[model samples]
Target chain A: MTLSSGTVAPGAPTRTATGSVTVRALRLLESFTAERPELSLSELARRSGTPLSTVHRLVGDLMEWGALERDPSTGRIRVGLRLWEVASLAPRALSLREAAIPVLEDVAAVTHENVQLGVREGDEVVFVERIRGRRSVRLLTRVGGRFALPPTGIGLALLAHAPADVQERVCAGPLRRFTPYTVTDPVRLRAMLAEVRRSGVAVSDRQVTDDAVSVAAPVFDRSRAIRAAVSVVVEADTGRPAQLTPLVRAAALSIGRALG
Target chain B: MTLSSGTVAPGAPTRTATGSVTVRALRLLESFTAERPELSLSELARRSGTPLSTVHRLVGDLMEWGALERDPSTGRIRVGLRLWEVASLAPRALSLREAAIPVLEDVAAVTHENVQLGVREGDEVVFVERIRGRRSVRLLTRVGGRFALPPTGIGLALLAHAPADVQERVCAGPLRRFTPYTVTDPVRLRAMLAEVRRSGVAVSDRQVTDDAVSVAAPVFDRSRAIRAAVSVVVEADTGRPAQLTPLVRAAALSIGRALG
Candidate 1:
């Protein structure tokens, strides 16, 4: 997928740190996604667009901090446990996931579907946790994995509740598509966001992947701010989004109470 | 909370560009334990024993990777979400936690106790996860917290299964005490470790805290190697240790199965 260079705002870290070699060293990390969890030093330098010397220094610092660890056999650097331990405590991710787990558990038990918890982080939604039954529909998302906040049900639910500026900024640019059903039109996406707020839940039918449909509802914090969103993803053709909506919404509400 | 000044024998990264400054920066990160999640820049430099310039440069690399995040309101450095995201995937922490969750959930549900999971990391047992029932007893250990593998039940369970060299080294000296009942004698501690292995369980009664008792059992990987342990901490005076043993051991066995 091609990212629109024009759509990348000036304030974005990707833009702000374009010239900093230290920042370039750090971007080497972004190359090690869940699907690609390890890389060689030269591979990192190549992917992050940095010199080998810069990559070496940066990797040393990162490995020292336990941000990156080397596979003993392959000597490839991968994201370290120390990094994950620290990130797991991010109040947005950990606490939200903790408060939502019991609720997510109940939802999973009831529907025997994939239950996901997510919160908005910038233009994306980071999946905080997911509980999948054996028969849960296949999906690409994993805990701590991030996805654009417009195409996912949880994303739509969160986006509908996001600040006006963030919504406008996101809608001002490129939209991504997975399947033919994925929403790509800015005006229509905005309309759907408004409808999500009015309806108290978000529904995406075969948007993320061809075989999955998701129903999600916003979770509120003690201050009545939208804190997170819970979604149930099921096999699209066999799933009844309407039938699953109330269960997902109730789980989100229960989690909201726990968060408060 | 003092660590001996030595190299991380297996995985420490040596910085050719910088000397002790590399390890010093790492020490700064090590300072952010479960008890201390955030620190000012001065605190970082002080704890690291590095010049402010070095600290500043190191912090830049760290912040770039999201291993260290600045608290937006306070402008202090805290363990970042990027770090936590990576650590949450640690096989020792995440996989162990995932494997133990169901069994821990069962124990927490049945006994309404504080269920814990931990694994050996270096000479210490790092708590990976915990499920606190509504009526759980008071406790000190926390998820992501570390303690010497000689006091807590889970720690003792792990220590029991460790190799001879590790056991001899641990029992040689530096047995810190948490309370009056803490076993400071290496000989006595060694005996306890042996008993834990023989009996396939451990009970830490008022070892760390005066009012709590933890019953623990070891969890094994597919190769029948000890990978971690699970425990349930309850009010010291409210339960029989004998009754809790079978339950904790069964839960640990269930977790081992999950791991396999």
Candidate 2:
């Protein structure tokens, strides 16, 4: 998902001509999104709102440190492998994905469905891992992409276990609807979340897309606190969410145990 | 692997007390490793060689930009999910991994061996993806980790196709020996690389570990230039590198075609 440039911390220093160099460099990085994975120097300067000369110097530093790379043939800039190496140490994403992959693989192997893992990031659900089954329906999600808390099963599971304020904030929202089956009513969404919390499983039927359904369950850490969520998504026409509920729950439990 | 702080550009500014703020911030990120994924602010300062006051301010800015995260329970800092999300767009790592995964999975499924993908970064080979089969031999390699260019099969494949300068530099010596079978002699390593180039595959028999053997082949891009390498590692005792060579080569070819 595209990072919002306005997501600055409250009370943080304002972005101005003399703003923090670190922030400006990071904004340059944020400018490279899924849609525009590569950009020229001028594009980077424009997108990051930095002076051309400053962007040039910052880009050089970033390239040297391996935070960004220059394409040899095209001379465009993209995220560097070294940055990915450091970011791989992020416990919230790759570490969690490592812990859940074996179990996710098992679910995908048995059900031949799209298996996913996600964690709450603010009011959004950041998908950390996804295994596309050989026979699974196409999903709109991708690894490292974010979705609203009430849209997909994995998001629902995480939202159900989230703090009250987060739940309320989502419940009282101008929720984006993807399909006719998507639950947009605050009352209905609350009931769905409550059911997820009570049953330890969330069934999202065609909520994200008209052709897909997902069954999800929350994963816990050693402290018995919900840390992430796992789900198995399948084609809506012939999907059996009820039958897959126990499998998804079992995978979630196994992932939680692995995390411990 | 621990990133060497000395890997700065040839003419980059010296990291003095009044050096670039962006460099200091990046060094702070470099302080976190696979082994020490979490660190206190003071530890970060110590590891990054930045003043505590500067580190504190940098850490604040980093945390605000979602480049770093503070664990709520431990109050320790680590790489943030936002950084990982941005890094996931790195074409050399995750994007290549995405293109190679289907073929890698096929190799893993058919051989029930350890599948790995790696790309050259300077003189080192950085592993971007790895899939351990259920019945595969244990491996020392991890995703996002770096290895020397002469020992592992994937490394050899990349090294064989590397630029002349890179190949010669690696062949110059001081190779770390991981096992009795690891090729330490520059002459022998050069011969191995030659064979890899001629045969379109590299075999590492008990190189990194005494009990495992790996067969690797180089993956090419649309321009027919070697971009990465793919390998399947198996138990040394029962492994048939000769039998697996063609399979690894085919997987590599499939991955390269996918990259097109």
User: All models: lDDT?
Assistant: 0.76, 0.86
DockQ (CA atoms), all models: 0.26, 0.47
Where is model 2 more than 4 Å wrong at Cα?
A1-18, B1-19
Q: Tens-digit lDDT track for model 1 on B28-113? A: 67656544567877787777676675566667656656667776555777766665565555555666666777778778779877
Best by DockQ: 2
Candidate 2 TM-score for chain A: 0.91
lDDT (Cα, 0-100) at B61 in candidate 1: 55
lDDT of 2: 0.86
Which TM-score value belongs to model 1? 0.78
- Model 2: lDDT of residue B207: 92
Worst 10 residues of 2 chain A by lDDT: A1-10
Supply candidate 2's per-residue lDDT for A15.
39
- Per-candidate TM vs. native? 0.78, 0.93
